[model samples]
Target: MHLLFIADPLHSFKIYKDTTFAMMREAYRRGHTLSVCEPQHITWQRGSRVSAQVLGITLTGDPTQWYEAQPLRRAELKDFDAVLMRKDPPFDSEYFYATHLLEQAERDGARVFNKPRALRDHPEKLAIMEFPEFIGPTLVTRDAQDIRRFHAEHQDIILKPLDGMGGMGIFRVGPDGLNLGSITETLNRHGAQSVMVQKFLPEIVDGDKRVLIIGGKPVPFCLARIPQGSEVRGNLAAGGKGVARPLSDRDWEIGNALGPVLQERGLLLAGVDVIGDCVTEINVTSPTCFQEIFDQTGCDVAKLFIDALELAISAGD
Candidate 1:
């Protein structure tokens, strides 16, 4: 199989922990040809198919110099057996527009994983709203009064921006409501933008668990990103320690419930963030933790993903 990965620059990848690197390495090991391009490389002319200037790569065993690559050349998206969209997010305007371009590629017969339309439809933070049963008491609003009322009712709450990734712009307000007004204004951009506020789950101390869903099934093991001292966010990027563990009963419950449903929507992979028993976010854009879980549990998450991708492509044929 020939695989094309639309991801961030190869040089920037932390190969040890990067999930896309794991996928590429696994696929390469299995005799699949690999190519890579960033989202910016994707282009579509009025009369031409969506194409990208991609580099054909061969994975080197050495971590320091991970991959050997061919010079960049233009290729139609439809030519690849699979195109994995692994771009990290702010999910800003450019990312949004890139999805449309990928969607056009899909129409041109490109088999894109986590389908372009599905990515647009499911905003990581907002996606959890669809499954209120799995989440905590949450509120999304731009109105300051609405946030204040929610704070009054929930006492201890977490306020976060709608598009924040890696735990950015997240704040916790206690019963005293310290900085509640300022946080509300800051997060909501003084009524210009909307924010999400949820009842604080003290279980965050246990870790903010990332339940990776691949091919509509749980990965069996999850990476529990536990917060360090004085930090409320348990994101790995936020200095949290990642500990891989077998999924708890509640974690299984959430993953099992959300897995197939999200898969049906063309999300070949997703990361369901769970704090205790509640679902906090449904990350579909580029759900990760593959290497962390594999390193500790020997689960071979990348193999599972590539297996699923192969099965999907073969089924389509």
Candidate 2:
């Protein structure tokens, strides 16, 4: 299979931690041709046809380092069996534009995992709000007064940008926590972008779980990311420790409810974060953790992803 990955630059990937690189390496090992491109490289020519400068990728033991095939424009992306939208995010306008292009490719018979329309509809933080029963007390708003009221009610709250990923701009405020006015100002100053304020789950002290789901099924390994001292964010990017473990019953229930919906929407792969059994985020765009899970449990999560992708392609055909 010839696969095109629309993602960040190949060289910038941290070999040890990047799931994209791990999957690319596995795809190569399976003798699937892998092509790489950043979001900006994708464009639609004519009315609805899409094309990108697809570079063949070769991954070695060191994930950071990779060799590339001569860069070339794939005049018709439909030629590739699948295109993995693996770009990391702040979920900005450019990312949306890339999805629009990918949606065009889908219309032209190219299978795009995590279907373009679904990706557009499902922003990580906002999507999980659909299942309030499974989540913690959460509020999304930009109004300072509302935020203050929420803070007053909850006392301790977690604030995060609506569109940010990798734990960027996540903050925790305790009862005596200061800077509510300043934090509200900062978040509101950035246009109408809302911030998520949730009751801080102290159970997070035990670390948060990142559960991977492929083809509507939970993978065997879940990584408990323990944040460093005085940090509220448990993201691996935030210097947290990744420890592998099996899913608890609650984890299975979360997956059972979320899996079919995600697969139905064409999200073949996702990373759902749970803090004390409360679903926090449904990570669709470029969900990581495969390497961490593999390193800790010797599970080849990359294979699960590839198997799902193959099934998606075959079913589409």
> Number of clashes in every candidate structure?
0, 2
Per-prediction TM-score to the true structure, in the order listed: 0.99, 0.95
**How much is the lDDT of residue 144 in candidate 1?**
98
Clashing residue pairs in candidate 1 (N, C-alpha, C atoms within 3 angstroms):
none
Please list the C-alpha lDDT of all candidates, in the order they appear: 0.93, 0.85
Write down the lDDT that model 2 would get: 0.85
- Candidate 2 runs further than 4 Å off: 60-65
Model 2: per-residue Cα lDDT at residue 179: 92
What are the candidates' C-alpha RMSDs? Answer: 0.9, 1.8
TM-score of 2: 0.95
lDDT of 1 by residue, 1-317 (tens): 99999999888999999999999988989999999999999999999999999999998899899889899899999999999999999899999999999999989999999899999999999999889899999999999999899988999999999899998999999999998998888888889999999999999999999999999999999999999999999999999999999999999999899999988989999999999999999999888999999889999999999898998899872
